[model samples]
Target: MTDTHTPRGLAETYFLCWRRRDFTDLAPHLADEVAFDGPLASVRGREDCLEGLVGLARATTHLEVERRLVDENDVMTWFSLGVGGSEPTPVVNWCHVEDGRIRAIRVAFDPRGILAAG
Candidate 1:
């Protein structure tokens, strides 16, 4: 869906798209060139982002978004991740948006947290 909200609102929409695993909704919000940095990998371009997210969604289950904070061009979201029937691990995602699309994304989470819980 098209975003008519302020920068922060646009950021929220992006997260909502992720929650639903709706890449179509997410794709339009990304520029032709985008960048993603996460615990697992770093990717660039809208196509790569789409591919990575699809793979991520397939590998993750029971994902839940908890907290969201947006200011200026930055958006931070905290979430719980469940994979392979394991307990949820806390993850923090930080994103930067420009012209209504994501310019950069950085995700931080404890790898040991997942291993410990398992």
Candidate 2:
């Protein structure tokens, strides 16, 4: 696992954790007061975000990161999330990192694809 102390490294590690379904590795990357503004729901706190991520992992079959952009403490990742055997759903996440952990995450995507697949 890459160092989560830096923005780019943290972003990479976060995606890697998701791809591997390693929520234990994922948890430490989040700050205690972390907030997540997801495509389907918005939440605050690390534990709540972790719970939400668990649901996302169950719904997603795979995730492929297509692109990444990092500038200082801000990181943006563009990826495709696969649901079952259906086509991959496109997603973008903007992350804010501070003090070696994620403070907030804002995700953009259409849930119609996953919903339709279900």
Candidate 3:
């Protein structure tokens, strides 16, 4: 499904595409000048964000959403990620929406939990 241009819609689309590792589906939900800030690095622009997300998808396995909260143009999602047979690591991502697409995203989590496993 395409992004619905709503805060909740954007969050759902993100997690859906992320779970499937479907960058194609995730692309349209990001604004042209989207920015992503994470524990590892920061990137700006849609292409750059997509590249980073794709690399992250490859490095990890079994991405799952554990909890989520949406308010207007902001969304917070709690996630679980794991590699191989290891335990899932907790991750929290905050997304800011603008013009029906995600304009910015900041993720917080224990880097050692998933980075080393990946």
TM-score of each: 0.83, 0.92, 0.89
Rank candidates by lDDT, best first. 2, 3, 1
lDDT of 3 at 17: 76
lDDT of 1 by residue, 5-90 (tens): 55666666766666677777677777788899987799999999889987777667767888888778888889898865667889
Q: Model 1: which ten-residue window has the lowest total lDDT? A: 1-10
| TM-score of candidate 2 to 2 decimals | 0.92
lDDT of 3 by residue, 30-52 (tens): 89999999888899999999998
Model 2 lowest lDDT segment of ten: 17-26
For model 2, residues 1-118, the per-residue Cα lDDT tens digits are 8877689988888888777766898788899999999767999999999898877777678799999999899999999988766679899999999888999999998988777778
Best by TM-score: 2
Following a full C-alpha superposition, what root-mean-square deviation does model 3 have from the true structure?
A: 1.7
Which pairs in model 1 have colliding backbones?
none
